[model samples]
Target chain A: MLTLAQAQTIMSAALAHAGTAGFKPLAIAILDSRGAQKLFAAQDGTSLKRGEIALGKAHGAVAMGLGSRALHKVALERPYFVDAATHAVGGSLVPVPGGVLIRDASGALLGAIGISGDTSDNDEAAAVAGIAAAGLVSDTGA
Target chain B: MLTLAQAQTIMSAALAHAGTAGFKPLAIAILDSRGAQKLFAAQDGTSLKRGEIALGKAHGAVAMGLGSRALHKVALERPYFVDAATHAVGGSLVPVPGGVLIRDASGALLGAIGISGDTSDNDEAAAVAGIAAAGLVSDTGA
Candidate 1:
């Protein structure tokens, strides 16, 4: 069970990491294991659709049970599969690197975090940092 | 042009109002006038689909240029029109009272806010309170 406190910690730490790294404005989303949204925040200057993009990444990670980094590769190798999966998940699957799965020390899935507004690699790094700060493991599927 | 700060204020106040009024845990969504999501939050214990429902209310409101209260009436009187409008808005239209339009003192549309988890009337009340806290006017389309 990903408690709200843990979700809030992840969000705050993710934004903090982005600020320290001087990344572009970001939108972040956290979804629990069941793919229910837990927390979300979009920076002041984020583009209009960044929130949805961030959410898509996180929701896709949870829905497919794979980090978006892995999904990105699947998208390249099997475009049809990815496309069908996107529709399967109700069009919220964004195959990209910024979505990461959250796990406990026991490797139990807790939730996922997604970030947007910077390069995909940088966004993934921020998510990794946030999960580590919360003493959880991040599975980027790399 | 809803700034992040203002959006945050609305979220916080809306949640606060819900808490004080002893409403159920809620999911809230804010979207800018351009129909872009600005901020979103789902309280602890919110059901899995509450976030989407909240977003649909707000998105539907902005897309239709009317608050969800009006949309609700339309859904009753002109079901086909409401159904078509929902399809037009990428299936994010939820015709209900929980969606309200945000306007400036000058009567300019700014964005919309949606809340779910309580009675639709209570949800609309919370949205109105939040908008007022931000010194904006709320049009429930009553």
Candidate 2:
């Protein structure tokens, strides 16, 4: 079973890296395997809208069992499915910046990570740092 | 005015602490002026069940002009009102844990923060770090 401690480590590392770089980041979200919220952080000065974007993106990643970027690939591969899903879910499948799927050492369904601030790539980079710091890795199928 | 930088800081600190102590967690949420979600992070192993709770709590906090704890107090004060609101809004008022209103130095509603992990207090503490780190303070409602 994936522990919350591991998730927290991943998130903290990301935030530290982002600070060092001086990025205009806002929120960070970490979800457990069952798609339940495991950890969350919201710094001051962040834009208000960031919360939803972060949740939607992270939720999408966890539910799909893949990173948002990889999920986006599936969307690209099957636009009809992606469009249908997004419409059906009422703006749930937001393939924007700041979303990624995290796994445990055994490649278990630990949860997902989503960030909102600056660009999508920047947010993703910070998230990656968090995961790496936790001694885990993120995968985005190319 | 709250920026994204603070949000990131708060969440990162929370995760670091949580990880060191060891706990299960959920994604963190950050909202902005319009009560819209702007930033988010999903830990690698958060459960899916807690996702809705985190979102609802934060949403309720932002929708109302009170901290979630204050809203909880009001809920106890007027169960009928909170219940009616819950039913009318499809059970959006989650008063369990991990929700706080974001305010400026002058006590203006900048947005809100929501977390799900460990316990309500644990979640709140993590969010607190992000808020304080971001150079903002949360109105804990005393």
Candidate 3:
């Protein structure tokens, strides 16, 4: 399980990156091993719904055992799976940026990170930075 | 039944734990026995869909008498039930994170925790921390 401290570091780094990049962001969230939310930050100039989107994207990553990007690939391959789960989950399940699945070096499931605001790609970059700054690894380039 | 205080503590603990560990996340939700929202946190950076997903997961946890993970698996097996529920709720049946069924010892229903951000696993972990921090029991393992 990634420690809360680590999650904070990630979020901080993400925030810093966002600020440096002059990106528009609302909130950022980090989860633990079991896909639970650990930390949440709603930055200034961020709307409330941005937080929800980050969470939803992160949720999708955790549920599917992959990042939102990977989920997007799966959605392309099998939209039905995504759609079915989407319906079951109500209005959540966005396969876009701002979400990444966290895992250990040994392939253990750690958790996920979500970001909102900016473009989908920017959100994803922030999430990546947050996780990386935390010293934990994200299952990416897979 | 988990009191509102407990629910709030659960969320706090979960957030603390997430930061300590290392994750990126979004929002979280808590539901009571009647499937009503008791506490909700729309963390920063969550996606637009997180609130709904969290609600759906929590709804599934309470309605199906299981955690959102279990509900997710079941929904995967039976997409129709998920489909039916979506229409039933005017499109509010997220079986994703931001939702987890909360239960008490002796297998009694208390409520649920729905989380967004990070991955579903991360969301689940956050919920676990929140519940544990609150000294409440979560039936995610059940």
Candidate 4:
């Protein structure tokens, strides 16, 4: 189970990584296995909407059980599916690179992390850093 | 004004208070003055619905410019108003006792906080504790 402590750890690591890498202020969202928000934070100076956008990406990743990068690829071929997915949840499911699913060492789905603020690639990098820092697996862009 | 650091401090204090009080697992939501979510978290073992419900209560408190307790009173006096409120916001408002408006020392509305997963009274207690811990005011019930 993704405990709140673990979620906070992941967020801290992600923010630390972003800071060390000199990325812009970012927001991070973590959702549990059931796609409910476990923890979320928006760094000071991030856009006002960063928190919500980060949550949408995390929710989308958890809903699909895959990284948003994969969905981005799918969006290229089937954009309508992306739109339908967003409409179904009444949220903006950003099919971008920053949403990544988390898993245990044995590959059990735990939850997901979404990062936003800098470039999508940088955001994804920070998320991966956080997942690794927490000793969890990122089942995206493997 | 509410900053991200203050929001984190509030969540930490709320969770600690809940743990000490031995309340059920909880979900907390904090929203900025603009009705944007600033922070959110769900403790381990909380039902998946907790986060959403907490968010709804917070949103409702913000929309009505009062605490959930007041809204609850209003709900009792005017059921139709509650129904309209729930419908008008696409089902985000929850007129319950777990939501509390947050204010600065100057009596400025900073945001609102919501708690769910325990009895309404317990939830309100935790929210109030957190707000006080952050040196903010909960302009409801005190």
Would you list the rank order by lDDT, best first? 1, 4, 3, 2
Q: How much is the lDDT of residue B97 in candidate 2?
A: 48
Candidate whose lDDT is highest: 1
- Name the runs in model 1 displaced over 4 angstroms: A75-84
Tell me the lDDT of model 3 at B137: 72
Could you tell which candidate, 2 or 3, scores higher by lDDT?
3
Per-residue error at B142 for model 4, in Å?
Answer: 6.9
Ranking by TM-score: 4, 1, 2, 3
Model 2 stretches with alpha carbons more than 4 Å out: A43-45, A87-90, A96-98, B1-62, B66-80, B87-90, B95-142
Interface RMSD of each: 1.5, 5.4, 7.2, 1.2
Q: For model 1 chain A, where is the 10-residue window of minimal lDDT?
A: A1-10
Q: Write the per-residue lDDT of candidate 1 for residues B16-128, one digit (tens) a residue.
A: 99989999989999999988888788888888899999999999999999999999999999999999988877899999999999999999998999999999999999999
Candidate 2's error at A6, in angstroms? 1.6
Model 3, position B85: C-alpha lDDT score: 61
Model 3 regions lying over 4 Å from their true place: A1-71, A74-81, A84-142, B96-98
Docking class of 1: medium
**Per-residue lDDT of model 4, residues B1-142, tens digit only:** 5788899888889989999999999999998887788889888888868788999889998887989998888889999999998898778988879899999998999999999999999999999999999999996533
Q: Model 2, A85: alpha-carbon shift in Å?
A: 2.5
Docking class of 4: medium
Q: Which candidate leads the pack in DockQ?
A: 4
